[model samples]
Target: MRLSQFFLPTLKENPAEAQIASHRLMLRAGMIRQQSAGIYTWLPLGLRVLRKVEAIVREEQNRAGVVELLMPTIQSADLWRESGRYDDYGKEMLRITDRHERELLYGPTNEEMLTDIVRTFVKSYKQLPLNLYHIQWKFRDEVRPRFGVMRGREFLMKDAYSFDLDEASARVSYNKQFLAYLRTYARLGLKAIPMKADTGPIGGDLSHEFIILAETGESQVFCDKDWLDLDVLDKAPKSAEELQSFVDWATGFYAATEEKHDPNAVPIPADRLHSARGIEVGHIFYFGEKYSKPMNATITLADGSTTPMHMGSYGVGVSRLLGAIIEASHDEAGIIWPEAVAPYHVGIITMKAGDAASDAKAQEIYAALTAKGIDVLYDDRDERAGVKFADLDLIGLPWQIIIGPRGLEKGVVEVKNRRTGQRDELSVTDALARVGA
Candidate 1:
């Protein structure tokens, strides 16, 4: 994409309201704009990153045997009433009313709606052990929404609901989601420790909150430092037994949110006990019949007995991840995007855009990169060399290719690694080869 044609309205000064580094950089980099207190309109650059994150989440979910299906943002309040949570879910729920006077709401979560849907069509044990997921917008009307998308009132979420015949089967389904979340965060270049958490409004005895440690985080977390080196991706899925082994290994670590922290519990050696602020990016819960029983989502068993299906809900904050990622990986210059979720793999900057030789060389490299199926954001705007370089750094593409009259005269272009701030001057072919294009 060409910068001149892109709708990036970058700002020179930070917005006073943005209190965190990710929020500040997002605004200054022209990734998003606030339309209201906690609502934002994602701009072109931000949307690209958001979709990339969503795609990773979707791919991992599919790999874990979860099918995808979108659910509506607005849901009838009747579903909540049927599940006996209408009165219990408090002011955080964004209640609304249609012109016809029917009760409606922007769903904060989909447990009630999904349960109602399952009860309507799924009968008997034949359709048991099903997982349905969606990527959709949700609203919670947080009383004091802050930290940009990290705590926004309106945000995008990847929510999956699983249904099974009994508690044992439900536990298996929960373990699948548990493993999936581990893989998902790893792919996005984040070390998200799954800590036992309190199930606030989404009542469940078994719950885990996947958190990324950040200085600006809202919650205090304790965990073993060894978790940082454990790699779930290297392990292969064998039987349910093997999968359970991996899950047990991950959960055996000493990790818990402040609410669940126990001083006398098995402690990490004092040197390895990590106490830090962390942001909760994903949460999973096995709620047994929390929604199913109340909503009559039951199936006839092989023994001819009818019983409510056990259910679980897993959630990843798709939008909030943009902020969490920045919080986890960034520097004083700007955001340092991970390669997997970067909007573009490379940023091609023509230091002297008006110079015929520099322009031609940049165009050639851009064409070659594009033909090789690379996502490159070309800075073709007529700006000073320093300005272009600063913008490229701010956007934080993994690699930067700098072309100028001087470099072109030497039959070379400068290639820079964003993460390492290392530069090398190589022939155009060598540069392209280095960038894998």
Candidate 2:
């Protein structure tokens, strides 16, 4: 993509309303724009990153044996009432009425809708152990929606529901999601610690929130220092018993959110304890029969008796992840995007766009990398070198190839690493091989 042809409306100054690093940088980088309070329109650059995040989430979910099926943003109010949670859900839920005066709502969550779907189609123990997932937009009427997409009223979410015939089998399904969340975060270049959590209105006895450490995080969290060295993807569980054991070992460390923290109850020694602020990017819950029982989502057992299916809910904050990533990975200049989620892998800055030599060299490098299946942002704008440098840093591509008139005359171009601020001058052929590699 060429910068001159791209619709990036980058601002030279920060927006006063942005309170955090991610919000300010996103605005200045022209990634997103506020459509209303707590709502945003994701610009082209932001959408590219978002879609990358979504793809990773989808791949991880599929690897965990969950099937995909999209659900509607608007759900019938009757489903909520049938689950005995209509009025109880409170003001956060946006209640609506169609022209026919039927009650409907923009779903804050899909527990009831999922239960209704399973009950209508699935029957008997043979259909048990099914896990279904979807990535969709959700809305909650937050009284005070601030901190940009971190706490937005409208956001994208990856939600999965698991159904099993009994509690024992349901646990195996729950464990799959538990491990999946950890692997997902790690793949996105995040170190996420799973901590015991309160289920809140979702109403589950067993719950875990996956938190990533960040100075600008909203929640205070405490954990064992060993978590810093722990590699969550070190081992993969292959059996039901192995899954249970892995989950037990993973949760064996002492970790809790501020609301659930109990200093005296911590099992780790004082020296091994580590406390820091964290942002929650994912959560998993095992609320057996919570919705199935109320909604009469029953299945026939092997003995021909009927019982409600044990169920669990797994969620990942798809849109909020951008804020969380920027919060955890940016410096004073701008966002330092992880390569896996970067909008583009490399950026080509043509120092003198109108210069014949400079333009030719930039196009050559850009075409070579693009042909190698790389996403390259070619800055062909007629702008100053300093301006181009600042924009490249602000956008945060992992690699940059700088083609200037002077360097072209020297038979080489400058290569830069955005995260390390490393720059080197090399032949054009060598530079392409390095960045493209």
In model 2, the worst 10-residue window by lDDT is: 232-241
Tell me the whole-model lDDT of each prediction, alpha carbons only. Answer: 0.90, 0.92
Alpha-carbon shift of residue 211 in model 2 (angstroms): 0.4
Model 1: residue 7 alpha-carbon error in angstroms: 1.4
lDDT of 2 by residue, 399-434 (tens): 999988888778999999999999999998899888
In terms of lDDT, the best-performing candidate is 2
Candidate 1 Cα errors over 4 Å, as ranges: 258-266
Residue 362 in model 2: lDDT: 85
Among residues 3 or more apart in sequence or in different chains, the pairs in candidate 2 whose N, CA or C atoms overlap within 3 Å are: none
lDDT of 1 by residue, 120-139 (tens): 88998988899999999999
| Segments of candidate 2 deviating more than 4 angstroms | 238-241
How many residue pairs clash in all the candidates, one count each?
Answer: 0, 0
